[model samples]
Target: MSDIATAAGGFRYRLWRGLDPLPSGLPTGFAALDALLPSAGWPAGSVIEVITPAWGIGELRLFLPLMQRLSQQDQYAVWIAPPYTPYAPALTQAGVSVAGVVIVQPPQPQQTLWSMERLLRTGACGLAMAWPRQPTPRTTRRLQLAAQSGHSLGVLFRRQHAGPCRHTLPVALSLRLDAAENGLAIEVLKARGGGQLPAVTLVWP
Candidate 1:
């Protein structure tokens, strides 16, 4: 007879199921974008990968609303090794809480990733945004785990290459941003539970 046992005797062992319900997501401030996401918003407690052909394509604009919302929270919105200094007046005008924002500039690339991981695991960081020039698969995986442990939202901005990456790291959401006519176009490469979605364009009002 097989060694495997059945539950006929009311066995205490429980069968493994899927992940439990995720924490409710924070609104993306765009109805269309929110609707497209699996959680109907930026999935909380996970890493979000944003790939772009280059800067100045409304990458920061895409998250302005999210920053404003996070500003109202008790946790800090931290920026790690940003390419350019965040314009305070612009962020303020966007309704972001300047007081709740924190910027960190690490001296070296290695330190940048290290700082990002530390901030995300602090539990007091509401959002940890980083622009990692060359993040390995293992590095991304560690960041994802840190975000989950601290329940923080981590955003990784990567420069778009000529072709798809050889190895795509698993993330809660992966988005590619492109400049559209008077707006930004978003292509969802992968969304947990939501799968891939058609590109959505958001016209600037």
Candidate 2:
């Protein structure tokens, strides 16, 4: 059987019936933020869009925990064009195994997205994260399809002020991050199964 078929046949996939069910596991980056996320974990086989006006709006921090958690599950976490050379020490501090993290440098944002999609389609990595300079609705839809086909998690980080695309993404949720005095604030702009909700603030350790 193909890798995709194997993933779909796995117990986790069966439990959720192909689509990811809520209340999954998260990384160990932040305690407070994990509490606010649905199912206290990142949703597999879904696309999560993270937007921020500034680079240090705790966006990386938000994903650290999720990465750490996924790493512990013996799954690889792939990062494309990460803004900063992920401090392996910092990742270790966050309880993530640096060994399981794969960093890829793509020539352009579009290439990065394409690489991410290919990885998601392989069902190899547990999670894939990318920072795309420009993301269209159509591109996101393709990513969603890839995630579902491979039963993997894909996250897209985009600029905060960018306008919505003409098409709609197949993402389960679209979140915007804002820096707060205490930590980071998350605004759920759009969601699929559930409607939008007020912005939720979370503190980072």
Candidate 3:
């Protein structure tokens, strides 16, 4: 005998449900983009892996809105081994409360991962971002678990072509980004409906 578990009301799919009712996503500050996402925004308490060809590239802009909101809520926003110095003026322009933001530049990539895990697992921070050199399958899984354990948001940034391994990682979401003249071109490699989603264009205001 099997229990019938379903989500999205009528649509039924054999999927493992989480311990709690699915939490709502944080608004991504873009209406069109949010509508495209299954969760309507960034999935909370899960690891989101983003692959980009280069650093900057408006990638920080993509999350700045969310970070601003998190800061407004008085939640800790931590950055691990950021590729560039996070300018205070830029953060202020983005509306992120500079006070609530913490940047940790560990001497080693391993230490960066360790720091992210602790912040996520302890719920000490509402959001954590890390730039990993090359995360192993075991490492990715550990980060995922740590975020889910405390209902925190974890974002792992990596360079493009650093993938192929992305398909094997246990992240809740995976997005490949290319810098566009005006914004970003995102390919949803993996998301709610499973692998194989079309690309979308995101323009910043």
Query: Best lDDT goes to which candidate?
Result: 1
lDDT of 1 by residue, 9-63 (tens): 3321222225456556889889889767767788888899999999888999888
Q: If both were scored by TM-score, which would come out higher, candidate 1 or candidate 3?
A: 1
Model 2: colliding residue pairs: 23-39, 27-65, 27-66, 27-69, 28-65, 29-65
Model 2, span 1-205: residue lDDT tens: 2465357653323343343455344443555544445444566677888778888777887777667777778888998888878788888988999888999999766698889889988777888989877777788889988987887889988776666553445677788888898788888777543344567778655
How would you order the candidates by TM-score, starting with the best? 1, 3, 2
TM-score of each: 0.87, 0.78, 0.86
By TM-score, who's the top model here? Answer: 1
Give me the displacement of residue 144 in model 3, in angstroms.
Answer: 0.9
RMSD to true structure for each model, in Å = 7.8, 8.3, 4.4
Winner on TM-score between 2 and 3 is 3
Cα-based lDDT for every prediction: 0.83, 0.73, 0.81
If candidate 3 were superposed on the true structure by all CA atoms, what would the RMSD be? 4.4
CA displacement after TM-score superposition, residue 18 of candidate 2 (Å): 17
Q: List the pairs of residues colliding in candidate 3.
A: none
Model 1: CA > 4 A from native:
1-20
